[model samples]
Target: MIPWIELDSAAIPGETGTLRLKRRGDEFSIMLGANELMNSRLSGSEEALAELSCAKLAGRKAPVVLIGGLGMGFTLRAALAVLPGDARVVVAELVPAVVKWARGEMAAVFKGSLDDPRVEIHTGDVASLIEKSKSAFDAILLDVDNGPDGLTRASNDRLYDAGGLGRSGRALRLGGVLAVWSSGPDPRFTARMEKAGFATEVRTVRANAKRRGAKHVIWLGVGHR
Candidate 1:
């Protein structure tokens, strides 16, 4: 096996562990110490996430979107491609270092998402952004800390809990969408979204456009229309 080369490390705001970006040959991984948070190529959930959230309103007025997590900026880049010119993309990344890494070492992968006119990168908990806003966003995509189950930071649990989910529901306008990318299915989570009064749907997408395997799930909670 080849050794993983250390690419960079960033300290997460209000969190103990630092976000580390590493690479081994062509394979890349983002980690918080021993735990691997996300793999570059294999994580197609983000693409699906951006797609699901942006759907149904592609040509509408300036759509305001909040994306939690800045991993590789794949989701952000994808969203930019699909959204209209007037759309606004606000990315809330808990770790400032992760933002720096994305701007530096992973610059090419992110391609201009950081400097894009429609983008606003916030170095704080995404939950805070949801809590502070009131029916402000057209779509909200939660790709932070591995779904509802938080492994890297204990505080991340709040983002998937009852209060966190409720805040997300309230942050959206009527018919606004809330999309979450999980590694696998979680029945309890789907139930929670229903409890929050969202017309929910659980969708599975391929890891890559050409690959064949069990599809990756992306949960979408649509608010009242």
Candidate 2:
């Protein structure tokens, strides 16, 4: 049987230890503590997020999209696939190591998203970017932390909180959408979105199955900023 091999490592601010990237053959996994943040085989939730978020920006000018995390660049690649030539993507990733892994070791997995002209990588907390931008994005896809219930970073809770959602609402242009990827469902987060005045929809998608099985949830929280 093949075993997981340590391929790369990087540090995230506020994390107790370094984030490790491991590989078993062609597949890869991201590890923080004992948890597997994500794997290469099944990025359905991320793809779903990019798809739904981009749907909201159809026909918008320049169509600026903000992606809160760049995990393997699946979401970004998916977004770039559907977005028009004039569209632009701003990705905020908190961990510099993660960025390095994506640019260096994980480059093949990312499929050249880093070199795309429309991409702008910001190495910082996504919240700060949200707070600083003024109605900038047509879509905000947040894959940082594990949805509303964060596991890797305690500070990520703010991104799922009402106050954070409010800031995200303010960061988008009118009729923009906020899509959040979750390993599981959170009703309270949905309620928070409702309270923040978004027309929300919960989408369940499978990692590989097209018909539906072993599904993951993506909360599509649509709002008019």
Candidate 3:
């Protein structure tokens, strides 16, 4: 077995703990204390977060998408693969260290997705962007923290609350998609989405593409027109 090596560690902005970047051979992981926030090898659900949401905008021209987290760049890369050439993708990452890890130690994991012509990196809170915009995105994909029951920061809880769901709905265009990736299910989250005027579907997906990993949840909500 290959030994895991700590590449670097960085404080998670306002969080008390720091994120540790570890590498084992070709694999990489981002850990917040004991909780593994993301892993390069387990990206099935994260990819689905973008795939499921982008599927909702099949006919829209130059659709704009906002991705709330850039963990391992799985969602962003997946979105770029299926979205039209003219479409734009804005990725908001709260921790600057995560961005540095993408460009530095984990560049291969990202595969140049950061430099894609249609993508932009916002080094700030995704919530702020959601609050400042109205009907600004065709799809809003969130893979922040550990879903509704967060781990990294208490503030992340806001992104799953009723008020946050309302903000997400307002940020999206009518009939647009709001896709959220979670480590597990939260029935209350589904209810919140529905109350926020979105027709919602809860899906359980395997973490790995081989379909042999932990069951992760993805909430696909289409904003009511």
Model 1, residue 145: displacement in angstroms? 1.9
**Candidate 2 structure quality by residue, lDDT tens digits, 90-151:** 99999988888898878889988889999999999998899888788888899987667657
Compared with the true structure, what per-residue lDDT tens digits does model 1 show for residues 63-140? 999999888888898899899988999999887778887877777677777898999988888888899999999999
Off by over 4 Å in 1: 212-214
Which candidate comes out best when scored by lDDT?
3
lDDT of 1 at 131: 92
TM-score of 1: 0.92
How high is the lDDT of residue 64 in model 1?
95
Candidates sorted by lDDT, best first: 3, 2, 1
Q: TM-score, each model?
A: 0.92, 0.95, 0.98
How does candidate 2 fare on TM-score? 0.95
**Model 3: lowest-lDDT 10 consecutive positions:** 145-154
Find the number of clashing residue pairs for candidate 1: 0
Question: Candidate 3's C-alpha lDDT?
Answer: 0.91
